[model samples]
Target: MKHTIAEVKISYHPNRLKGAVKITSSEYAGKVIRENWNQGTLNLYEEFKILLMNNSNEVLGLAPLSRGGMTGTLVDMRILFATVIKSGATSIITVHNHPSGKLKPSQADINIYNKIKDAAKLLDINYLDNLIITEDGKFSFMDEGY
Candidate 1:
């Protein structure tokens, strides 16, 4: 008997022209993410997403990683990084919404940011700001000196 392994292939297709909307700062990122978010659920539950970008800070794509209850959501680093790598993004900005309209980063949020930041350093990926989106406004980790 003979056994064969499956072949694995990886690829990335640009849905939009390069540098269509360059990310200049966390505030700009918030605007972009807000436009892509589902406003109907902004204050209904917790959702985590990522903004994938190229070397020039051009938009590559936005991916919703997970959804959870009113309090928190699960972010699997493996899934997050896989999406980042597959998108051919050189940088990533993490975004998550708080239904309670709170802009402060929770301890869990900080922990996640630290893990992603550290892992990004190891993988040569640019880890940008982590934004906490509220119904009224947003919070930036970099702006607050995280």
Candidate 2:
């Protein structure tokens, strides 16, 4: 189901995200990320995949992995990887929202990240980043050195 900001209450908390995406000066990338953020309420759990050119960092595609509950999104790694592979994307970034507005990564979140990282490595695809977006903005685990 699609969610709007009016349908949910969001709580903003620090440490809500545990991973990061590399910042590029590309306006298109920024716009895509922001547009997706605006599409739903803060803290709504949803998974998105961003395809990036290995050489120029140009954004290739932005696709949703899943639409989840208020607080959690279930991502299928196979679907995520398949999309990236099919796009011939050498690198990709994964993003998800936390409905709680807390940016801290949960144990489950870390575990999932590790699994995705490994899968990407095996496929010779770079998992560029896993970002946590909230109403306030976005968080990057790689930026924070997580």
Candidate 3:
């Protein structure tokens, strides 16, 4: 008997990188993330997104990873890293929104940030920032000394 093995294929589009939005700071990242976010749902529920970026800090794309209730969402580390790796992003910025309009990183948030930062270091990817977006503004872990 013969067995067949499935093959994995990754598709990358370099053309999209032209004139892409560049993330210079957490403030700019917050603005960009907000622009791409669904305003209708910004205050309704929790949503997590990842910003895939190239070496020049130009955004490749935004990937919505998970959605949850009003207070929190789940982030799968394996899926997160896989998405970054597949996109060929040299760095990443992770963002999540709080429906309650609070700009604070809970303890859980810090734990996950540490995990992601460590993983990024291991993979040689720059973990730019972890942002918590609210209706009013954003809280950046990097800016707050994560």
Candidate 4:
């Protein structure tokens, strides 16, 4: 008997964001990403999403990755890099919501961001910014020169 393994498949539709939505600054990208959040869930659960961008800083699409309870969300770096490569993105900005409404990144957050940044470097992909946001405010790693 012969057995075949399933092939890994990746899909991205043409639903590119508006061409005008250039992520020129952390503030701009944060605002645009915020609009994509699930309002009903934003204050209740933490969620992670990636703003995939092209060479021109044109947003290719938003990839919603994970969600968890009020405290935190889990991110799988393998999945993250796979999505970036499959989307044909040259760079990415990671955004996540803080249900606590506090903008500070815990040590775990910093550690994960560094891991992702290191992996992106190895893959030749630019890891731009990581935003920790609440509805009223946001903290940007790039803004802080992290």
Candidate 5:
């Protein structure tokens, strides 16, 4: 017997980073990531976005991955890797908001980062940083030596 299954394909336009806005520090990435967020809806839900970058760490684009309830969001590894590969990203800085305005990363957040980092490594993609954002402030895993 033969089995049939759905197939997935990845594709994107030829747009590259403009202005060469290189990410110099965690603070820089934080600022850009926060700017992509919707301030009014920030406190209402948890959303995850990845800042796609080139080999020079310049901004390529930002892709919103998932939107979940006020507490947490689900990240599918397949979708995450697919986005990076599709966009031809050399590296990525992942970020998500904490609706409670808590800047600390939960255990789940850490786990997610590790998984993402490891997977990216195998694909020859750099996992630059993982950030937890809030209205008042932001947390950078790389700054914490994670």
Candidate 6:
């Protein structure tokens, strides 16, 4: 007997992402996005907080927020702030992937970015950029300015 696609089970090993690390360039960011992609037909969208050093451009930690469908990922301001505060980071870069393989930032994406930016300002945590990665090896928003 063979298991059909619908019969298959999938679970995300959140522990596999423990011990957060750094993300330097967009290339490195792309690599991170690729790792979160699911093999199933459904697209995998993940929110990450990239912590940076105050003086230099060194990365401190890469914290994962939520992982699910494109419209399903809910980014909580409290969680985001707690992660950054605990990490003692002064600045951060936000990243998310578009499973449709298009790097364009939708209106909702822009709204989220603005909200995050506003929240970051209150906490004095600089929101550097919000990146969108596609399955076709292309990136948008941060590079082209959405």
For all candidates in order, the CA lDDT equals 0.93, 0.67, 0.92, 0.89, 0.91, 0.65
lDDT of 3 at 83: 95
Candidate 2 regions with alpha-carbon error over 4 angstroms: 1-31, 43-45
- Ten residues in sequence with the least summed lDDT for candidate 4: 12-21
User: Which 10-residue window in model 6 sums to the lowest lDDT?
Assistant: 9-18
RMSD of each: 1.2, 13.6, 1.2, 1.8, 2.5, 11.6
What local lDDT does model 4 show for residue 112?
89
Worst 10 residues of 1 by lDDT: 10-19
Going through the candidates in order, what is the number of backbone clashes in each?
0, 14, 0, 0, 0, 0
Cα lDDT tens digits, model 3, 41-117, are 99999998999999989999899999999888999999999999989999899999989888878898888889999
Candidate rank order under lDDT: 1, 3, 5, 4, 2, 6
Error of 4 at 14 (Å): 4.0
Model 2 — which ten-residue stretch has the worst lDDT? 12-21
Off by over 4 Å in 4: 8-20
Tell me the deviation in Å of residue 105 in model 5: 0.9
Q: What TM-scores do the predictions have?
A: 0.96, 0.72, 0.95, 0.91, 0.90, 0.66
TM-score (C-alpha) between model 1 and the true structure = 0.96
- Highest TM-score: give the candidate number: 1
TM-score computed on alpha carbons, candidate 3: 0.95
> What is the model-wide C-alpha lDDT for candidate 2?
0.67
lDDT of 4: 0.89
Candidate 5 per-residue lDDT over residues 1-146, each given as its tens digit: 99999897656786653477789898989898788789998999999999999898988888999999999999999999888998888999999999999898899999999999999989999888999999988999998999
1-146 per-residue lDDT for model 2 (tens digits)? 97766655434232222333433733334456777565545555555555444444555656777877776778788888767766666877777777777878888778888988899899888676778776666677677676
